[model samples]
Target: MRILVILRQVYEQKSIQWSYEDRKLIYQRNSYNKSDLHALQWTREYKLKADALVDVLILKKEEEASEENKLANFGIQRCFRIPSNGSEKEDAAFISDLLKNESYSLILSGYETEDEHSCALLPLLSYELGIGVLTAVYQLEGKPNGQLTALRKEERGSLQEFTIQLPAAVSVTSHISKLRYHRGRSAPDFTMIEVKRQLSKPEAVRRIEAPEPNIWYADTPSEEIPQLRLLNIMGFASQSNNSNNLQKQTDHLSKAHLYFTAERLVKWLKE
Candidate 1:
């Protein structure tokens, strides 16, 4: 059984980083970067060091796509490029083509790209390709009949297990494992991979520039708190019955009286 690990080549050096001190986001060009760390983590956990046949699908922007070819030491089969269309759909379509021919039994990709408008594309791709998809996968176990069981990490420190047939897609989360390093500097090898460059020339409908950021400060007057609302009387029916079972009526005051007076007695009688 063959496996294809789809990975994105990001600027391992300069990328965005969240900052709690500034209460805003910041970009880190150097120092401990995430993409490289993430890639290395997958390499170690997946055991893709030596005899692993894998392919990396990277999308590069213009002015860098052609020149952005660098060897990732981990066993990567091939690296395909998509034109810098600047749209999520374009990127998805590019990935879809790479996955079209039913090339590999299992495909592993990161949960989200490094782009600002980041979206988990595994669901859409799986729907498009008619393949099973699992997200936040931490542990992958080989099973009989070319099937694999995925141990996924859910919210609140919970984990869920699922079994998927071969030829399925998975969106891997960063927290799944730790990144590893490759000692040698030989160029990565690729397998029998195929990708179509221009699926369709999409015309640009419109382009709008983002507005500049503006920091503003305001001052407001402090006022005393208002007194709590006081009910004239705790109506018997309103207090007894739940809000949902309490029906609304057109005759408002009469309805209230009927509800409080007769309904209350009827409720006790029914009980």
Candidate 2:
């Protein structure tokens, strides 16, 4: 079986700064998405257990030496790099076209990217490739008959089990087991292939100004006596708190009768 894991480069949240004047964010450092790392770890374990071939496709702004070295240390033999166009739709289309000739039993990717927080690419790719996609998968196991059992994490801390056939794609969540380091492992001579495709220019982005802060202030207390002020606010004079007025209001309420007749009550109930 052949498994392909899609990895994306993302900016570290701690290394990002807000440019208030430009109304945009500035990125200082790049790192692998945490969920993608989990997916890679899962793929590695699956490959070891099932003796399947695993490959990684990296979507990055540019090919970096550090990233290549990292992949070599992970012992992946073949690595594919594609320039990211910063548009999910374009990237999905390009990848779908590039993967048309490849025969992979399963494809794995993170459920969502850290920078965009969008799950658009995988679904779009699945649609173009005409394959089923399972999302938010945290645990996966392969069966003897080319079937996979996946445990998906749902909202409110719930798990849903699914049985999927081969030739499917899965998006993994970050809650899976962390990656284990292999010490003293010999670095593999990995093959780095750069895939190039012409992509349309990304649309211009509009900047928006920050909203003004809202503050509430309390009303100043009146100089009058507290009891008198309370009475005035309640639409009652201090002198109108006598028992006679209260009795008159109570009598008015008691004298009020229901206007609905038996026929009307029966009609309302029927309706």
- TM-score: which candidate is best? 2
Query: Residue by residue across 1-271, what tens digits does model 1's lDDT show?
Result: 4555554534433365556576554673322224433643564445533334556555544444332223455555566655444465666666776667657766666766654435455567677777888876777666646677788887566789898987888776666566654555544454433344654555657543343578665333232322211221322233344563455555656766877868779988777
Which structure among the candidates has the greatest lDDT? 2
CA lDDT of every candidate: 0.56, 0.77
What TM-score number comes out for model 1? 0.57
Per-residue accuracy of model 2 over 1-271 as CA lDDT, tens digit each: 8888889888776788778787777765788777887888887777677777778888887544345555545546578888887788888888888899998888889998886687877878888899999988878889998999999977566789999988988899987657776566455567878788665677758554554578866454463799767765666655555643443222243323233345558888777
State residue 171's C-alpha deviation in candidate 2, in Å: 0.4
Model 2 pairs in collision:
none
What's every prediction's RMSD, in angstroms?
12.2, 11.3
lDDT of 1 at 138: 72
